[model samples]
Target: VGKIPWWKEAVFYQVYPASFKDTNNDGWGDIPGLIAKIDYLHDLGVDCVWLSPMFESPQKDMGYDISDYQAVYSRYGTLSDVDNLIAACHARGMKLILDLVVNHTSDQHPWFQESRSSKTNPKRDWYMWKPARYDADGNRMPPTNWRSYFAGPTWTWDELTQEYYLHLYDTSQPDLNWENEECRKAIYNEAMRFWLDRGVDGFRIDTVNKYSKRTDFPDAPVTMPGETDQPAAEMWCNGPRIHEFIREMNEQVLAPYNAVSVGELSNTPLPSQVLPYVSAAAKELDMVFEFSTIRLGTGGPFHGKYLYREFPLSELKAYVATWQQWLEGTDGWHTVFCENHDNGRAVSRFGDDSTVELWEASAKTIALWQATLTGTIFLYQGQEIGMVNMPKEWPIEQEYKDVESLNFYGEAKASGDAERIRKTEKGLKILARDHSRIPMQWDASPNAGFTSAGVMPWMRVHDGFKDLNVEKQEGDDESVLRFYKKILKMRKEYSGLFVHGAFRPVLQEDETLFVYVKDDQGSEESGVQVNKRRKALVAMNFSGQPASLQEHDLDVAATLGCKHGEELLLVTTLKKNDFSRMEAGVLKPWESRVYLNF
Candidate 1:
């Protein structure tokens, strides 16, 4: 209604290209494969496409370790193929954004290669390279006591120079030194500009807050139990110069192109701390993803992505409400998402994935939850069809492609602790990134319609693809994919209230139920007629049994502002969806509904 940007009202779909579809049957998805699915994405109500890393890489961190910034991976395609893909998206009024991972480069990248070469090369200062420290007449040590995000020490001893190189992740992925202005300029021109100039709309910047670090490189004081290295998040995450670097980027690259950027800010949790990055006046970022809620189940006391527990639904209210209320009328915007390429499926992690019968209902419930939230929607691959996580029975060696998963399992197995090994195995099977990276179930073909029959996919296809594939549910009126379409349609229909209205939490303390009210409460005050205001309510029962509506908190019948009894537009879990009245009543397990008054 106001002067909001196009992205504020658009929906984004993230495609893990390697697992989406393989047209050439190379055991990997390629640009031609993505081009074939363009109409499908447009039909799913997607306005933008967020492609995971398909750039030239060593695949050490699965494309995060970039060997060349301006080239596409040979296995995926050539530069001309990427150009064609971008044209296909634009033909359908869609925007395509690439993954910008400039925090580091592959150790084999030409820049890093020269940096590690004699230690006095022109690019020697391009990366965070430090000398090995001697332990006072004892053995040598790393420059700091920091742990690599993948597992080992942050410093890797390069045999060529006998000096150490700093890597926050795997040794193959070395960290970039943003302290050097020349390196920063080269990265901007080579990596970001190359794509943006080629008709690419923008970037989903990876680890946006990690560009700056504590110059001293102090030893991390935080350590989990039974660990040799510490998680040095404090020394690097959202450091003092974080905002400065972002502002400079906005000035140098983003502003001139008139492009949008949604940054990955995994470690910055608090709303106040993130305002600088997302504040519209600040011109830093359009929006950011914060992970205080997403990180609860994993990385608690553990050093890596070991599942410590389930994501608590009772605690969901406070987390969602805090962000919604904090940035309601400010210069900042919010990002609402539950699943991505880095995490487990939404239905498995947040909803019940216990039985085949519950999968559809639970997936619909979560879709309703995501739809009603007031922000841009981001759907990962296979989420529309309600794809659940990889079966827990799949063996690790077959499906575990993530480096973090393998590193944890390898070390646990070597210790000979049977209990530790058993728990870790089950956890990785349930929560590892492999669950999200599996081949997208397009149809009931031998390879889930992803690759050829006998040609094996890079990862094993989930067995449920036989019955749960897209073809099986395409015409079904009440399928999970259909539910998403209907809900998103409703949001667009009432964009006045859903997209630009105010957000309020109702019954914030309820454990098994999540209810929120979204309305244009201040429209009249802002010079509109009183009769034209709108209000809507969204409720979800995140449980397997019945849940009751609190009468005092929500007198749905008397004060819901509805013209009809309820004016129910959608009830996802109900088979018939015949509800017409708003009243205090019992809700069935996994039921979610939207009631509106316009």
Candidate 2:
């Protein structure tokens, strides 16, 4: 705590470079625009910021499909822009975390270009390529039954070499052949050396689990209906050799610099398998973004109707609790989040955004929960103001660049059926690209205050911009922005209580009221003991109806710096810390407060 482990107790804000700010009025956000907002981030009290990919790319996958590993994209600005931003962040006492998309690259990349040039090309083995198998009709078949996460077959036949190359994601994003030591080392050298040499603080690795595949190239079982192709990744995600490869990368690149590495592992990863990948032994990542809580659903199109549904509150609580409990005493750490650049806004999914007061209330509740957790806290761009997901009825055109979402829509169309398409739309409403990639709402002006050049933005901003924006919130101390700033400041002020305090569930029968406690060692029984009162309690009433306590909940003390006193600490609604008793003079509707009683 001497030098200040900012990552351990600070908020990490994520910026989707293209949508954050526009400098040249080209309608696309650039680095210079982001530099203009460094003061805004510092004012928000964030200690670290994790930026999404901005490397040279074909834009087929929106920068995830890297065309050049080391260079900056021309549209995002030059290396000078990056250096200037880094210097600015350091000067403000904030750290920067870069997104490292090493799992794959654009098929147009130089390595792939060389590998595709000829079978004897020096980089020929840089990617996974397999000879096609002859079908019954003598037509060529893809190497495996692997379906790309996108919508079609994972293997694309390469006529140049009479072989099939694996693309676990988009066909344009060919998977790197990690089995080849040279390929692994080359990727490590390119990604690690470029950033570390440039003085980056750490990385958030993209799709790290996809690197390991089963050696035999076995087909994956189809979970989605009507899916036949099972690409090589089915046999490999989180494979046996993943740890070995991660360890090598860490030893060769990450360990030397003491950088924070957060792996993006989709598909609820098991803690036992995840621990080694994020062990503190300087061998792998510093933490990982596990998608367990987000992926919970009842059923999908393939399954009968109503099979997939939004996750129940109990399920989400249990999902997060499992991983949090496992990493408690271990050196391993976890990255916790409700939304990101890839997922939708957490407000609509988790908060009751039907009304302004309700939305603001629920938003603060979620923020409190995330900020008080053990792992690093991640706040999506618009989340600070409690932005909700886009309405499903709102027509979204075909210009969307998110591959995962577009693929689902295309798959529905291929079936010549409206039922699947309807379900797909519904699925997206619950969980899809529309949630996370919306344009940042900066003001109540045109384009939700995102742009003033009168140009069309890459994506539509929220319609409620007239009331919800940075400029409006900046002046109002009772806004969600103020609440977030206060939360961050509280965490930094009492870093020890939040960073290392033990988490205990404050079990409640009501699903809407998700409650818990964070206590220091020694005082377990008396909820109000000083030695054990390290930020004592945390609670949120997700239930729409007013909720309160039946009796005195252990003599509530300081309400975690939240606005609940005669004088307001923070407030999104007009009322400041105003509460009324229920039938029996207990807590009531939408009432949520956290206290450190002693």
Clashes of each: 0, 26
Weakest lDDT window of 10 consecutive positions for candidate 2: 566-575
lDDT (CA) per prediction: 0.82, 0.72
lDDT tens readout by residue for model 2, 95-208: 888998877889989999999888899888889888888888998788887766676787898888888888878999998989899998888789777787887898989988
* Residue 41 accuracy (lDDT) in model 1: 86
Leading candidate by lDDT:
1
User: Ten-residue segment with the worst summed lDDT in candidate 1?
Assistant: 522-531
Per-residue CA lDDT of model 1 for 335-447, tens digit only, reads: 77888887778788778889866777789988888877776778898999999888888889766899978887887888798987887887776677788999999999899
Residue 197 in candidate 1 has what lDDT? 93
How displaced is residue 213 in candidate 1, in Å?
0.6
Superposed by TM-score, candidate 1 places the C-alpha of residue 520 at a distance from the truth, in angstroms, of 2.3
Regions more than 4 Å wrong, model 1: 299-304, 522-531, 550-553, 558-571, 577-584
Choose the strongest candidate by TM-score: 1
